[model samples]
Target: MSNSKLYKGSINTIILKLLNEHNKMYGYEITQKVKDLTKGELNITEGALYPALHKLEAEGLLDVEIAKVDNRLRKYYKLTENGTKETANKLEELADYIKTMQTLINPKLA
Candidate 1:
């Protein structure tokens, strides 16, 4: 499996969390935000970003708005009602996972 595979499973959660914090964001914006936040440790590629966005939209957890910018259309994503709820749940789940990882990776911290 690819190194990015580990982060693949949490893509939705990451997207939801970002949308939860920011009202809406475009695809490239999201990628930049992640890179900036992680200090370039995590870079979200187009291949991984779009599919996850479409999946979340299809699942009714995300809402999209298209706007004309610089003579081009830009799609911005935000959390829907269900997505807001899901974001909270996903955040909690991520927190739990972090705790588990901490225990496993640094037992002294646990």
Candidate 2:
């Protein structure tokens, strides 16, 4: 399976979890953080990342702030009030999904 296809469902949860931990982050910073955390195993493309961010913003789950830095405007994202509440729930859901996958892969472990 393609990496994007495999990861298509969990990107929102991943982004929420990162924002939960870091308070705020910009797009490229978020991408690099994911790569570094995963030891380069997962690569989040701009094509995927930006759309997800936009969707989350539209859903009222994320708030954006713009800052002028080094002659460029940077947009940073942080979880909104609803997003903060949803982040915990999403993390739980993602964990459950992981456990289910593990159980399917190893019945003996289950």
Candidate 3:
């Protein structure tokens, strides 16, 4: 699968899960974390990352704090109380999806 297409489906869950684990992270940090975790399999582009961050912020699932990092302004994202709950739900849903895909892909084994 194309990296763009794969990220399209998993970006939100990935973002939320990262925030859940790390408490807070900036955009570039999040992108780098994904790369590190996936060992370069998943690359998150600015085009996709910013929009998802905006959507999540608008939906009240994320809280943003702007800060000066070195010589640049950076916006850090963290999960709101609601976001924490939603993260759990999203993770559960993702797990279910993986299970379903696995079953379908290996029905004989299943």
Best by TM-score: 2
lDDT: worst 10-residue window of model 3: 1-10
lDDT by residue (tens digit), candidate 2, 4-91: 6878898999999999999999999999999999888888889889999999999999999999989999999999999999999998
Q: So what's the TM-score on candidate 2? A: 0.94
Model 1 gets an lDDT of 0.92
lDDT for each residue of candidate 1 in 1-110, tens digit (9 for 90 to 100)? 02477887899999999999999999999999998998888888888899999999999999999999999999999999999999999989999999999999999999
List where candidate 3 sits over 4 angstroms from the true fold.
1-4
Q: In angstroms, what RMSD does candidate 3 have relative to the true structure? A: 1.6
What is the TM-score of candidate 1?
A: 0.92
Q: Put down candidate 3 lDDT per residue, 1-110, tens digits, no spaces.
A: 13867458888999999999999999989989999998998889888899999999999999999889898898999999999999999999999998898899998766
The C-alpha RMSD in Å for every predicted model, in order, reads: 1.7, 1.6, 1.6
Error of 2 at 31 (Å): 0.6
